[model samples]
Target: MSRKLSGILNSMHEKNMDALIAVKPENIRYLTGFNPSSFSLLLLKDEPVLFTSKLDIEDASQSSKVPVEELKSLKDIKELLKGKIGIESSMTVETYKKLSNNFKANITDLIEVSRMVKSPDEIKNIKKALEIAEKSFEDVEFSGTENEAAAKLEYNMMVRGSSKPSFETIVASGERSSLPHGTPQVTEIESPVVIDWGAVYNGYASDTTRTIIETDKQEEIFNIVLEANKKAVSAIKPGVKTSEIDKAARDVIEEYGYGEGYIHSTGHGVGLEIHEMPSLSQKDNTTLEKGMIVTIEPGIYLEGEFGVRVEDMVQITNRGNVLNKLSHKLTF
Candidate 1:
């Protein structure tokens, strides 16, 4: 086993736990290095093992660092448990109930906590994914309807080596941009378009959002968003709380009278998945640490009018280091 895997196993043993059952696909990948398409399970202990469906048997056998077994039924898994069992908090309540029948079960975030800090190889993969995503954006023609722009952007990312778009490409244009999570539509592009997109490379993900502004009002909002993003990036340092980072960006937006318009959290940790731990939100108290990769995205949505968002990936070192080199300002 790798040192990281050994560390996680040692931690489990320290807690007087026999084994940890991980169901989340990202968690499974973190420990085993295999990305499962269907249902999968990871039992972490001294001799870790993975249970995957038949569909993934070939892929799991090839990519998984741990031993793989065909998952037959819950009854079979129940037989594998020996002592006190641990489960991820993100596990569904139904699964928890089913798995807790015979063994003493406790909820734990062992895998997620470990994933907060990225390894050197993981960081390199994320950086490469970001490069592909940024390059793909430059090739997208933003003059057409929102859906057309999104389709073109996704195609560009695919052709440039992305396995897929990290998420549904957000191509909100005109007044629709005011909705923070607005979906692309058939309507023609307008003065301001909020393009939030990402790319996946070798299963690692990158997330970024940039707004193109056409008029002074749009530029005004864009400037405020940029200011928030800058402050948030500057605020990242070891020991700083994730919520504090959110406030740093929020404060900038509020100072310019767009606080209410800034709806979502500052950002989130990104790795094998688009959304991960150490959420940069008011409710999250995760402390910043070295080797943590996160996004510093800030936005202002002037409901029913227009919106602007600026985002960039930042890998937390001794200090915050922006991973993306693309210019924030984009005009057409």
Candidate 2:
């Protein structure tokens, strides 16, 4: 894991970056073991340093893999700044203005690119997160309002040591499921409830969606979605283009005359963030590689009707190793 620091530094050297400033929490956590409780910065060069505000200094000192110091002020940071400074593209404009005056600040995705591949520890954390989410889901009762079910599942995850839900707990039921990013509601649970949620453990995440169906029409859609999900997962392998995997799922749905219903990308890389690099979409051209973790979630949503989605996390290797063993079909 310490080699990640060296690898990124070598990348900076090749780019002629005199130094790099990192503020994005995930990137900071990737480089340093500690996730910041407040504002923090990572100064990258030959000898990297982690700077955290007074509020986070104690915790940062205890876990930060790199040297930790108090981030006194922006001006103090300026004093240490050098030429051709590289910064994350996700940096806030206000902070960019603070340090832009003295350095040749350039927006770069160096850290994100490096993080696309997972190390063994990262994969382990993601697996633990998946275990928490799946176990919580297994105990969810089909009876109740959408909000209540979501609340129960999340509380169960917390008891299992997941610090929080990686994303909003989605329990979109009935017609509301047609909305790809539907929020849970207080309304009564109905047939065909689409529950999409994840849990976070050790700062890594696991995302999965299981739609409970009762009607014949809903079952039809779910089977088609299941086929797409299976084919896509089967297609994941090192050296294959990410888009090809998406196409594999999309083609299956399109052949079934439901292409338009499959609204979103087939999947996306998962790690510190639910959505990251190497998106499994027709537009993304990144080649799949070993050690990358991603989700295969293909759904068919019919407007004014319910939606059916089947999602599972897969780790890229010689072949896709699906991390979720939960059955795709959920019933009362």
Candidate 3:
């Protein structure tokens, strides 16, 4: 077995876990190197194995580093469990109940915790994904409706070799931009448009957000958001709490009396999945560590008016290093 796989098995043994049941697609891909299209499971132990449907068998066989087996049903999985099993906390309650009847199941985030720190190879994939996303944005013509702009940008990413968009492309314009998670609509482009987009490359993901401002008020909010993003990035370092990084950015907006407008967490870890552990939010206490890549996005939303957000991918080394190369200021 590879040293990394053996290390994970050793860790599981230390925790008194006979097996780790990974249901999250990202976790499955992280351990096995196979991306599943339908439901799949990974049982991690001394001899790690992957269970996938018939449709994914060919892909899994070609990509998976470990042994791959055809999955018939949950009943088949239940029979495979021998002793105490570790399950991810993100597993749905319904699935948990269904799977917990026979085995000693305990909720664990062992895989996610390990994923917080990126390997050198993982970082390279993330950088490539970011490069594709940034280049695609530069090629897009921002002179159309929100939906058209989003569609064009996504097409560019795909043509440039991204398997797909990391998430539903956000292209909120004008007042709609104020909604932090606003989805693209058929509305015409306006004074300010918040474009939050990402792309998937070789199973890794990159997330970034940029706002194009065309009004004085929009510029004001943009500056505040930018300042917050900068402060947050500056605060990232080994051993610092994730919440502290969040406050470093949030305090800036709050000091400007726009605290209430900042509705979401400052950022989150990105890897095989766009969103992962070590969340930079008030509720998360994960400590910063080397080789971790996360986003530093802060925003200010004015109700029924407009909003601005500046986001960039940050690599936590001995200090924070911004991975985005594009200039923050963009105007139309």
Each candidate: what lDDT?
A: 0.91, 0.92, 0.91
| CA deviation > 4 Å runs, candidate 3 | none
User: Could you arrange the candidates by lDDT from highest to lowest?
Assistant: 2, 3, 1
For model 3, what is the error of residue 140's alpha carbon versus the real structure, in angstroms, after optimal superposition?
1.3
Q: Write model 2 residue lDDT over 149-213, tens digit each, in one string.
A: 99999999999999999999999988998988999999999988999999999999999999999
Model number with the top lDDT: 2
Q: What is the lDDT of residue 251 in candidate 3?
A: 97
Model 1, 1-332: lDDT tens per residue? 97779989889889999989999999898888899899899988789999999999999999999999999887788888889889999999887777778888888988889998999999999999999999988888898789998999999889989999999999998889888889999999987889999999888999999998889888888888898899999999999999999999999999988888878999999998899888999999999999999999899888879889999999999889999888999887
Off by over 4 Å in 2: none
Q: Could you give me the TM-score of model 2 versus the true structure?
A: 0.98
Q: Locate the minimum summed-lDDT window of 10 residues in model 3.
A: 1-10
The local lDDT score (0 to 100) that residue 255 gets in candidate 3 is 98
Q: Compute the lDDT of residue 290 as modeled in candidate 3.
A: 95
Q: Provide the RMSD of all predictions against the true structure, rounded to 1 decimal.
A: 1.2, 1.1, 1.3
Model 1 vs. true fold: TM: 0.97
